[model samples]
Target: MGGFELTLDTLRDLAEGAAVLGTGGGGDPYVGRLLVEQQLRAGRAVRIIGVDELPDDALVLPCALMGAPTVFHEKLPGAAGIVTALRTLEDRLGRRAAATMPIECGGFNSMIPLVLGAETGLPVVDADGMGRAFPELQMETFAVMGVPGSPMSIASDHGDAGIIDAVDNRRMEMLARAVTVQMGGSAYICDYPMDAREVRRTAVPGTLTLAARIGATLRQARDDHRDPFAALTAMLADTIYSHGVVLFRGKVADIERRTVAGFARGRVRLTAMDDPGDQMEIVFQNEHLVARRNGQPAAIVPDLICTLNSETGAPVTTEALTYGQRLTVYAISTPRIMRSPEALACFGPAGFGLDDPYVPVEQLVGGP
Candidate 1:
């Protein structure tokens, strides 16, 4: 599909797909769904355009909610906050955005751009920086491809806002994160303002549509009484992701999570539903970073590690994971663009303070 209008009929699919891509991070997709639905009900429109459809020099500003997902559950970002930040960035650059795009294809971040599109009457790009979510602001394909995150703007629902101009993307993350904390743990941001030419080369292509497909696939499978996991893996085999595997099926045994450093940092332990001795542990910083099963790495960063409800095939975000929840943890390989040397250096295991080297999820999991 080249482009399409987002209507109330398709909004749920996009939200569900985004939550799966979130990989147990990003904010709550259900909350995001409600937010976007609210806009559609208000008679606004969200038009999504594919990467190839973008004009070469048209300005495309990426926007998202940056903060702890746990905090987001208690507070919702207002449409005005997002618009305020986008306008701030636009004012600094002296260019009105031809389109808005998602920084990541996860939960609230994915839908926030759609909300912006509906609110401002600008088309939302059907692509994103990280094909999935990552905690740090600089951990995006845009930054890896040399797009600076500066001239970034942050705004809160209460009307507070500021722009950050930093020498490097990392410094930009630090400064913006500090501002996010002051704004009460969560805030909306517009950053990496680049023309469509840069976006076509740097962003993960067609992820918004891909996310919608994922959501639709799960829904269809469930409606048909088919195995949603099997259906999901089969569908992913045909995408840029290439491979998907159900790494483990278990119940949440323990969870130790905390909001720290402007991120939801923690680890969750799960025990096999049938085998008490078989266990797995997944760690995260706003996003699932790694998964280890029986003391061996099952999935590592740069790949997608996600948790889904065992029965409904619905994704469960990190903030919502709780003890005794039955879940099917799965991993999908990221596209080659995300595995380049520079990309790995930005979001690889080392980036999250892990000693293990980056490993493709298929190699680690013995995929279907």
Candidate 2:
């Protein structure tokens, strides 16, 4: 299929779908949905193109928000920040951007590129660095596949901006995080500046479109009075994320979230509704990292650990999670590219400082 236009009607699906793929991070997409809506309302258009559609030499600028997700709920970002960040990066590179793409297939991050596209009339590529949202900048397929994340530019809503040309990808994350903290805990960033050739080689393809498809499936299931979780897993069956499983169904027993050192660090405990003694715990640093079911590893990164509303099947971001809420937690296996040694070494359990080794969710659950 070719590229499609993002109409107002479709924005809802894209936002909701991206949230599902966000894996309990990426901030809330609702703020981004409003931003995109405002843009579309003003008669601007946001077009999405597949990676194959990009010219080999096309300069693609990938953008995202960096900092604690919880801070974003209060210090909201605006279009000007991203636009400014893009221009600042282009000025540093001495070339104009041919197009914009997301650094990750996250709720707000996915939509931010669309905001840039709508503002600049540049087509947004339908791919991203990470197939799912990650907490750190270096935890990306692009980084693992040899893309330098330096020459990065960050901007705040107040118009403050800075560029960091780090020596390495990990350094880039460190320096960027420091700046994001100074920018009031959250900031928009343009990084991983690369040509379309590198993008096609390193990026996770079709993530934006895939997110829209997932959103539509969940909406249809709910409208038809079908089981949305079943529908969601069924739809994911044919995708790159070929395996998915409902790990636990319970109420939030306890939550401890805090903004520390530019990241949202926390853990949540869940008690099984039928058997209170049976419990699950998930630890996160900006994004959900590892989930332990009764003190055993149920899912670990680079696989996705997502939380959803038990009754509505809507995704719940880590910032929005509250105590006593009934939620369904599920895990989706990462694509092969993300499971390779290089990829795992970048975002595996050890990368997040966890003791559990990298284990595919499919293996842990037996199968999808």
Provide the clashing-pair count of each candidate structure: 0, 0
Residue lDDT tens for model 1, 1-368: 47898877688998999999999999877877787899989888789998678779999999998999999878877788899999989999988999999999977799889888888999999889999999888999999999999989999989888889999999999998898999999899999999999998899988998899899999999999999989999999889998999999999999999999899999999999889899999999888998999889999988989999999889998889999999999898999999999999999987888999998988776767
lDDT of 1 at 126: 89
Cα lDDT, all candidates: 0.90, 0.91
Question: Given candidate 1, what's the lDDT at residue 11?
Answer: 88
> For candidate 2, lDDT tens digit of each residue in 286-322?
8899999999999998899999999878999888889
Worst 10 residues of 2 by lDDT: 359-368
Stretches of model 1 off by over 4 angstroms after superposition: none
